[model samples]
Structure formats: C-alpha cells, structure tokens
Target: MALSPCGNQSAVPTTFLLLGLPGLWETRLGLCALFLLLYLLTLVSNLLLLAVVWVDTHLHVPMYLLLCALATSETCLSLAVVPQMLVALASLHGTAILSYQGCKAQMLLSGGWACTNCFLLAAMGYDRAVAVSDPLRYTTRMGHHVCICLVVGCWLGGFIVAGGMCGAIFWMSYCPGQNPLNHFFCDIPPLLAAAQGVTAPSEAAVLLLSLLVLGGSVVAIVASYGSILVAVLKVHGGRSWHRAFATCGAHLTVVVLHFGCASFIYLRPKDRYTLERDCLLSITYAVVTPFLNPLVYSLRNREVHTALHKLLVQRRVEG
Candidate 1:
C-alpha cells in the first residue's frame, strides 16, 4: 500500500526488489546485453512469422492462424518480462524494484501469455491430427469460423486462469520485511515464497489450478499426436510419412521444451525449489523457447520456407 526504498525506513515494504542472478553479479552487464539481443531477435522473428502468415493468402488456414496467435503470445510474454529483467540485470546492485501493482501486472501478463501459448500449441496439434487423419474433412472441421472461435477461447481461457492465479497468490499478506523476490521476475513461486499467511488450502488451490491448465493441455496434445501417429502408420507412402514426421517433429520439439521447462519450475515440491537453480532454468522458458519457435518451424516446415521465398521474390520485384 506504501512505497519504501530498501533502506529508507523501518516500515512495511510495499515494493519488491528483484534479485537478478546474484551468482553472476559481476557479469550482469554482459548478461543484460545477451538478453537484450535475444529479446530483439525474438521480436523480429516472431513478427516476421506473423507478417508472413498474414500476407501469404496460401497460409490462411487453421494451422497458420494458430501459429500467428502463438507468435503474438510469444511477443507479448517477452515484452512483459524481458524489459524489466534487463533493467534488473543492469542495475548497480544487480536488482530492480517494482511496486505492488507493477509486480501484479507482470505476473498476470507473463502467466496469461504463457498459458495462451500452451493452449494454442494444443490446438495446433489437433489441427495437424485432423490434417493427417482426415485430410478431406480438415477444411470442413477446422473452418475459418471454428479457428477464430478457438483462438478467442484460448486467449480468454489463458487470461481467466491467470487472473485467478494472481488473485489467489496476491490475496495473502506479503511478508513486508521479506519483499525481495529471489528471481528476476515476479514469478508465482518467488511471490509465494515471500508471502505470509499462506495456508494449505490456498496453496493447494493455486497448485491445482496450475495443474488443470498444464495437465489438461498436455493430455490434449498427447491425444492429438497419438491419433496423428496412428494415421501416419496407416498410410503407405514415403511422402506422407515424411510430411507427418517433419510437421510433428517441429511441434513436438517445441512442446517438449516449453512443457519441460514449465514442469521443472512449477510442478515440483516447494522444498526442491532452489532459487538460484530455478532462476537459471527459467531463462530457457522465459527467453530461449520463444526465440526458438520461429527457427524450429521455419527449418522444419516446407510451406513456411516456400512462403518466405515467395515473399522475398515479390519484394524484389516491387522494389
């Protein structure tokens, strides 16, 4: 409710201090530079993916629409976390400060966008399954209206879940004296670690809600891929087999990296959470994974490569 600097007074701290990777304090500036570079590249690549999808009418399909949404989520998630993280890394004390409201905003956006990506990935997996299993009806089943509804549902569901998570976490009394977050961002674990009056029911509620989002999405992805694998095996052509593997390979790679990093961070017991190790591992999901999505899809998806080439050639002719 009130703000005080770290050493300003012996009053309740209404602000949070983000302790950036303390183990690498001496190299904070270097880390900051590296993160900044990654953020820019992530933005450019994701934006290019969105633009390519938008301009290439040939890609105006359910799958590419889901990808466009994923790119958007990745961009927003990076924006929510990376800029403030850069500030923390560049701070003289290797820390950054955030007001209570600022911290909640960060938590909501980061959580919402991350959740959106998970759902979107599941939706994409289902799209691919339908494509492989029932190509003739793929267009009918995944029509434009259906895809739009799915995208809207994913965004709405993501923020709604995030809102509930944030509300539950922030409802408790924060430990005023223990206002320093061990991680660079106002993540759920760090915030819970610093909060007082955390009851078993409240913690269980939060954990259950998280598991519902993640666990449900994982089940959907597995089911979709299982169907895909069955259909691919039923087919008798190398071309079909090659297409299925290439497409699923890219999506599976991303799914593994994204879900693996998230599971490592959120699904573990509280006692196993070493702040230092967790903070280091969070960079993979928070930064590296977003940066890798465009690359993985571009390298693995032949249609994307052809679209990019066509766009480049069109630009050359126009220029």
Candidate 2:
C-alpha cells in the first residue's frame, strides 16, 4: 500500500482543525457563552469547596477528605479541556485548529481528570458504606494512612490509565488528510474515526482499558453500596437507613450522572458515534458534571455547610 506523504508527516508540526458542531454556525456563539458560564461556575465552586475542606481541620474525616480530593480534581478538570473548547467556540473564523501535540495533550489531561473522578467516586462509595455498616470502626478502618493510600492510589491509577490510552490513541496510524476532528475536542471517537487500518485491535484495546478503569470502578461502587444496604437491613431497627441514605445520596447522584454520561461516550462503538450526541454527552460528563458534583454535595450534604461555617467563623474571629 502506497501511503501518502501526509501519513508520514504525522510526526511533528501536524495540526488538526476542530470543526466544532458543524452546521451550527449560528449557535456556536450561544454555546460558547453557555460553556463559559459553566466553566466559571465549575472553577469557583470546586475551588471554594477545596479551600473549605483543606483549611477547616474539622473536615479531616474520611468523607470530607475524599470530597477535598474530588474538589481538587474538579478544579483541574476545567483546566484539562474546557479552555480549548472555549477557543474553538470563540474563533471568529469558522475553523479552529490545534497542533497535533496540543490535541494529544488535551486528550491526555482530560482523560486523567476523568479517571481520577471515577476512582474517587468509587472510593467515596466505600467510605460511605463503611460509615453506614460499621460506624464504630469507620474511623479505624479508613484511618489517616488508609485515606492517604486511597487518594494516592486514585492519582496513580488515573495517570497510568490515561497515559496508556492517550499514548496508544495518538500513536495509531491516521489516513492522509484526516486533519479535522469531527467534534470539538481531541477525543476517543474522533481519534478512532481518523485512525487507519484494522481499527478493531485499537478499539478493543481502548474499550478494555476503559472498562477496566471505569467499569471496574463502577462495580466497586455498586458492591460497596450494596453491602451498606444489606448491613442496614440487618441492623435491629433499620434506623440506619436515613443516615446511610443521607451519606450516599449526593455521591450516588454524582456517580449515576458521571457514569451515565461517561458510559455513553466511551462504551459505544465507532459506527455509533454521532458528533452532536457525543458533544452533548461530553458537555454533560466533562463540563457540567464537575460543576454539579460540587453543587450536589454542597446543597444536600450538611457537613460541608458546617465546615464552611466553621471556616467563616474562624476567619471573622481572626480578623
């Protein structure tokens, strides 16, 4: 097969123009405005939650600690991919282009954030289950060391999975002139679509890795919560259900929203990939969900309010 010089030049200096939401030229500006609002809200809420959790020593328990880690991840989540999207959306010209290296960088960073989110959500489920099923030993079980280990494990796992996936996706062969990604960001579906020859292997590899990380995390979350449910039922009066539900309710909401959008984006085959649908899914998972996670926790979880109140009071007294 006589491969075109274009494929050979896939080396350095190769850039791809992102044709963001094609045929929606009139709507790009509106969408950009909406996303900008979302981006700002995500950053502010997550960062504030992080500050409260970090500074307030009262919030050093397992649940808050996990939340602190989540807020940090969400803060970085905006950094990983939203700016490029804003750039694409805001471009005066119809086309928005990114260098090959830049595109790969976006994908890697975003994937890392998403991976971290998955692991943290699962870990949180475990923490809640422990608090519900074994309140007496919850502190001892998820002690300082265990909490540190869990957070560290999430970071290491996210990095490894994201790095491997991004590396493989970018390293695959792309046919000549496949420069414009069908969607906004450099993502799996668009990347897979552009790749050349025997895509099954690459697709399988991506799917397996995704399932191993996301699917496995989801299973752990479900199992942990299921155990909590069982333990609640076994208790003398079933009084623990309220406490357990309160603890897991917000996290459960987040997990469902996160996994639902993520599964739609990641688990589907390439033939089923539709740009507009993928764009909406990405918005839900990548952009809106991060913001909503913090919002959900803050509104529904009373502990966060207490921690923030304590922090504010401390600040007032110090002043």
Among these predictions, the greatest TM-score belongs to: 1
Candidate 2 residue runs with Cα over 4 Å from true position = 1-13, 175-178, 236-238, 313-319
Model 1 whole-model lDDT (C-alpha atoms): 0.87
lDDT of 1 at 34: 96
Residue 171 error, candidate 2, Å:
2.6
Distance from true position, residue 78, model 1, in Å?
A: 0.3
Judged by lDDT, which candidate is best?
1
Question: How close is every model to the real structure, measured as TM-score?
Answer: 0.93, 0.93
Number of backbone collisions per candidate, in order?
A: 0, 0
Worst 10 residues of 2 by lDDT: 1-10
Q: For model 2, what is the alpha-carbon lDDT of residue 7?
A: 43
Each prediction's whole-model lDDT (CA): 0.87, 0.84
lDDT string, candidate 1, 108-168, tens digits: 9999999898899999999989988999999999999999999999999999999998888
